[model samples]
Structures are given as C-alpha cells and as structure tokens.
Target chain A: MKIGVIAYRGGNVRSICSALESLGVELLYTAEWEQLRGCAGLIFPGVGAALPAVQDLQRTCLWEKLPTWDRPFLGVCLGMQLLGKESEEGPAPGLGVFSYAVRPFREAPRVIHMGWNAVSPLMQDPLWYGIESPFYVYFVHGYRADVMDCTIAEAVYGERFSAAVRRENFWGVQFHPEKSGEVGFKVLQNFLSICKSYQP
Target chain B: MLAKRIIPCLDVHEGRVVKGIHFQGLREMGDPLSLGLRYEELGADELVYLDISASVEGRKTFLTAVERIASRLRIPFTVGGGVREVADIRALLEAGADKVSLNTAAILRPLLIEEGAALFGRQCIVLAIDVQKEAPALYRVYSHGGRIATDWEVVLWCKEGINRGAGEILLTAIGQDGTRSGFDVQLIRSITSWAKVPVIASGGAGALHHFLEVFREGGADAALAAGLFHEGVLTPYEVKLYLHQYQIPVRL
Candidate 1:
C-alpha cells in the first residue's frame, strides 16, 4: 500500500520516509492534496514550532486539506500538536481534528522532555497491536496535548498527558515512532496494516 | 519515571568500528552496520556513532556509514565527530540521524550551539564534553579528540552549554575512558547536580555494577560504553536485567 507523507519546510521528512519504507510500505512525499489521492494512507511528520509549522501548512494549502482526509492519517510530534484547536507554543490555529488544546508543560522539572519514556494504553485498538502496555517510545517536545475523550494512550513526565490520540480515520502521536526503536516500529506496522485493510 | 538508558558507543575510524585502551592503541571491532544492529536487537536503549578520526583529520562525519546504519535500525541514533556548523547538523539529520553531537566546534564558536538549537531545536543538538581531571576534583575540557585542553571547567562549561540551548550533555571523562574501571562518579555527581538537562556518563564502564554505580551514585541518566560492549564483555540485555532486579528502572 502507498502512504503519502505531507512534506513541509521544517518537518523531518527523510527520517519518516526511511522508517516507513523499511516496513515495506511505498511512500509518496507530497504537499499537494491531489497527489494524496493515489495513496491509501497519509502521514504528517513534523519538527520545530507550531506557528511556523502552521504557516508552512497554510502556504502549501495542506492545512485546509488535512481534516478532510478519509484514509488512515497519522500525525507525529508537532504534526500531532497541529491537530488540536490551538497550541501554547504559538498563536496559530491548529487543524482542530480533535477537540483538545495543546499547551506547554507547567512546573515541569525540565522544559524540554527529550528521550525514551513509557506510554500506557487507555483502550484496546488496532493501532497498539503487538505493542505492550507501558512501552518505551522516544519523545522530544515542550508542548503536550491535554487529555480528551479521543486520547488512546497516556504518558507521565511531570504530569499525565496525552501520548497518542485517535479520532475515527485520524490518528496522532506526540512521540516520534520513527526513532523509538522496535516497539515504535510495531506501532507503525499496525498503522500500515490498518491502511491496507481500509476499504476506502 | 523514565528508565535509565544503556547506550552502546561505536568509535569509527575510516568506516570501521574500532576500540582502544584509554583512547590509545586502536583495534578494529567490526563493521558499524552489523555491530549497531546487533546492539539494537540486544535491547540497547540507543546507539552513538562517534567518528573518532573526523575532527583529527578535519573532515565531516562519515555520512555513508550513518545512512547505512540508520536505514537498517529502528532506534534512536546519534552521530558525532567533526560537526562544525548548522549545515552539518542539518545534513546529518537529513541523513536520518536523530541527533548530532557538537564538540570542538561548539567550544571554538559557542554561538554555534545556539544557532544549531535555534535552527533544528535543542533536542537535535547534543553537547559532548571530553573532560580530564586537572587536579583533585578539578576538571578541564578537552577538544579535537582529547588532543587540546581548554581553560573551561567541566561543570561551568556544561552549565553554559545548557544555557546556550543544549538539550542533553554527553560527558566523557578522559582519565577513565577505556580503562574499564568505572565512571568518574565524583565528576558525574557534580555535573549532574548543576545541569538540569539529562547527563549521559561515558567512559570507564567495565561490569554491569559499574553501570549501576554511575546511575545510583553518579546520578547519571544514562551510561555509555564502547570496548565492553564491542568485545561482548557485557550485553545490553544482561545489564538491563541486572538493573531491573536492583529496582533501577530499565526497559526489558
């Protein structure tokens, strides 16, 4: 199956692409919404701040097109933050795919939470698949998504926050599965399988 | 709580992984890709590839080796040695490396740390400090593969590096490197207390107990070793299991 990774100015396109390809999934890196028609799934990988990332998405017209994507869609890190209504990191409006707001960590021992941490699944879902509960995944961010009904997994650094969120066809993970080792790849593998089985 | 990390460091010279005693008398370990994959499969938390000769030869890191290893493994990998500018960091990240470490260049132009962190985020910039004990409890920073010593003290330099936007510090004690004794617990304890960021204690790791001491006594968030891991002296799996038994959180 083919997956389209939305390419932006500051996103980690190469690493995301390499990770997906290693799982035997064909990738199409594009910003044009029309180009995504041939793919069965979509991935939005990101790095950098929210304001500039939203500005780049708007510039490429992907911001307006993201919410309507019918296939299995995954957003990673800043990509996941962009799915919220807004972020404390910047003044830009997020895609609002989920009814949650992204905010910076408060009273955190450290501002930047960088490294491997565990996540506990809140419910059984195909996205988790073979991954064990409280599996270690790589995270590097300052802002976190507030817990909501759509939250699938939660992790605690200074406080409990959303680690992975799912809303129908759209999925978002605050961690970088591309760099989270074998456990991380299991999550990606699950997503790819979901795409392959997706009727649309 | 975040589990303590066990990282296997690969010192590469001319595209071959090498090991040395106290950074002298280098011996070839094996190919970077195979050794890296082996460590990853053995449950290593992360991997570090240091081009030991890059700075000495005045060239960039071996990108080909990085790309090959990065493509094969599905883990967080850091590449260091001869990283001198923002462009170099960008190039390494573009080649699929999760983080790029700065050493000699960061010391020469301190602002490069800020520039790199600003361009690629602080999480992508790692400040690697090679420190030598100048006197009792006094440590000095070394550069260019431990060939040149600087006036900057280890603790103060690490604090400055954190202030300049380094998200993590890779502290290697030159006196203990490859000696297989143990980590410089005093130096690590002092640096960890002052630095708010995570400290990765490198050098002088012989047994699994050494790893435990660095974490428990030295207050290190992570421990790294080259020779012991490369020579099969201790497997990452065995170390993690040992740490888990001691109630020191580690990913099994």
Candidate 2:
C-alpha cells in the first residue's frame, strides 16, 4: 500500500521516509493534498514550533482538510501537538481532532525534556500490538499534551503526559518512532498494518 | 521519570571516525555509519557526530557522511564542528542532523544561538562548552579546542547560553578528557544546580561506575564518552545495565 507523508515544510521528514524505505514500503512525500489523496494512509511528521507548523498547514490548506480526512493517520512529535484544540506555544488553534490542549512543560526539573523515557500503554490497540508496558523511546520537546480520554499511552518526566493518543482513525505520538530503535520500528510496522487493513 | 541518557560521541574528521589523545594525534576508528548503527543496536539513547576538521573540504565530507548516516540510522543523531553562520546550521539540519552543536561560534557570536533558536526552535540548538578548572569549585570556559581560555566563567556562561536560547548544554572538561579517570562531578554539579537545561557531562569516563557516579552524585541528565566507547573498552548497553543495578534510571 502507498503511504503519504505530509510535507509541512519542517521537521525530519527525511528520517521518516528513510525508516519507511527500510521497512520496504512504497511511500510518497508531498505537500500537495492532491497527491496525498491517492495514498492509503497518511503520516504527519514534524519538529520545531507549533506556530509556524500551523501557519504552513493553513497556507497549504492541509490544516482544514486533515481533520476531515477519512483514512488511517499518524502524527509525530509537534504533529501530535497540532492535533490538540490549541497550544500554549502560540495564540492559534490546532486541528482539534483530539480533546487535549498542548501546554508548556512546567514544574519539571528541565524545561525541555530531551532523551530516552519509558512509555506505559494504558489500553490495547494496534499501535501497541507487540509492545509491552514501560518501553523506552526517544523524546525532545518543551510542550506536552495532558492525559485525557483519548490517551492510549502515558510517560512521566516531571508529570504524567500523553505519550500516544488516538480517536477513531487518528493517532498521535509525542515520541519519534523513527528514532526510537527496535520498538519504535515495530510501532511503524504496526501502523502500516493498520493502513493495509483499514476499510476506508 | 526521564531516564539518564548514554550518548556515545563519534569524533569525525574528514568523514571518518577518528581517535585522539587529548584532542591530538588523530587515529582512525572506522566508518561513522557502521559505528552509529552498531551503537543504536546496542541501545544507545542518542549519538553525537563532531566534525573536528578545520578545512572547507573537510566540512563538505562531513555533510556527505551526515547524509549517509541519517538515511540509514534509525536513531537520532547530532552534528557539530566548524558550524559558524546561520547558513551552516541550516546546512547541517537540512542534511538531517537532529540538532547542531555550537561551541566556539556560539561564544564568539552569542547572537548565533538566539538566531538559530528563533529560526529552528530552541531545542534544535545545543551549546557545547569546553571547560578547565581554575581552582576548587572554580572553572573557566575554553575556546579553539581548549588551546585558548576565555574570560567567561563556567556557571555564568552556562546561564548566559541558556538565556540566549540553548536548549541543552554539552559540558566537556578539558583536563579530564582522555585521562579516563572519572568525570569532573564538582564541575558538573555547579552547572546543573542553576542551569535550566539538561547537562551532558563529557570526558573522563573510565569504568562502569563513572556513569553511575555522574548520574547519582553529579546530577547530570546524561553522560558522554568518546575513547571508552570507541576503543571497545565499554558499551552503552553495559553501562546502562550497571546504572540500573545501582538504581539509576537508564534505558535498558
């Protein structure tokens, strides 16, 4: 199946593409919605601030089309933050695909949480098909999404925050699966399987 | 809680991993991509590739190496060395470097940190400080590969760099480097006490206990070692296991 990675003009999209190529999957990296529409699944990979990413998405009209897109989707790092209703990093609104609001990490020993951390899965899903609780993954961000109803996995630095969240076909993860080693690669492979089995 | 990071730094010169004694007498190790892939397999939390060459041709070779490493490696990696202007930072990041480490350039032009943070976000910039102890609990920053000493004090420069938008600090002790005795815990404690970002303690990692000492006593968020990992003396996975036994949180 063909997968399209949304080009929001920022983040390590190259690494994501590289990871997918290693998995031997056919993929398309494009900024145009026309090209993405033909793919079976979509992956929104991003890094950097929320303001510019939101601005770029709005400029390309992907910001409006993504929330309504009826296909298996995944968002990574800042892309996960963009799925929230709004962000503390900026004075703008997110896609509101999920129920949480992105807020800056406060009361933490360090402002930016950068390094490896354990993720605890709260419920069963295809994303955690072979994963166990308290698995380690690489994380780097100053802002975090609070644990809410849609949160599937949670991790703690200074406080418990959403590690992975899902609602219907939308999946958002705060960690970089492409950069998380073996377990991370397993997560990607599971996502691909989800896309292959997706009826839409 | 966030697990303490075990970063294996690869000092690259003209696109090849090199070994040195106190930043002199360079000798080749092996290909950077192969070493990096192995480290990732061995459970390295992250990797840092410092391009130590000074020539323009060396810089080009480093970028090509970065591309090759970025394409295959599944884990995050950083690139440094001779990153001067905003354009250079852009080139490294565009080449797929997760973060760009700035040492002398950030000190010479503090505004580079602000500009890089503003353009790419603060987390993309890392302020690397080479330090030398002046006296008990007294340290001074060094520049030009520790050949020249600067007036900026260790703790003060760390705070200044953070204020200028450096998300993390890679503190390396010049005196302890290549000695393989132990880390300068006192120096690291001084910086980690007040500095807001994560502190990566580099230099003087000899045995398994040093990693535990830095994390438990020194309060370092991460520990970095070059020769110990490069020469097959220690591996990141073994160190993490040792740290875990000592009740130190590390990715296993």
Q: Give lDDT tens digits, candidate 1, residues A40-94.
A: 9999888888888888888876777789889899999999989989888877788
Q: Considering every candidate listed, which one attains the maximal DockQ?
A: 2
Q: Write the per-residue lDDT of candidate 2 for residues B27-47, one digit (tens) a residue.
A: 998899999999988878899
Model 2 TM-score, 2 decimals = 0.98
Q: Which ten residues in a row have the lowest lDDT in candidate 1 chain A?
A: A107-116
lDDT of 2 by residue, A1-200 (tens): 89999987666688889999889889998889999999889999978778888888889878889999898999999889999999988766899999799898887888898888899999899999988777999898989999998999999988999999999999999999998989999999999999999985
Shift in Å, residue A90, candidate 1: 2.5
CA lDDT of B82 in candidate 2? 88
Clashes of each: 0, 0
**C-alpha lDDT of all candidate models, in order:** 0.87, 0.90
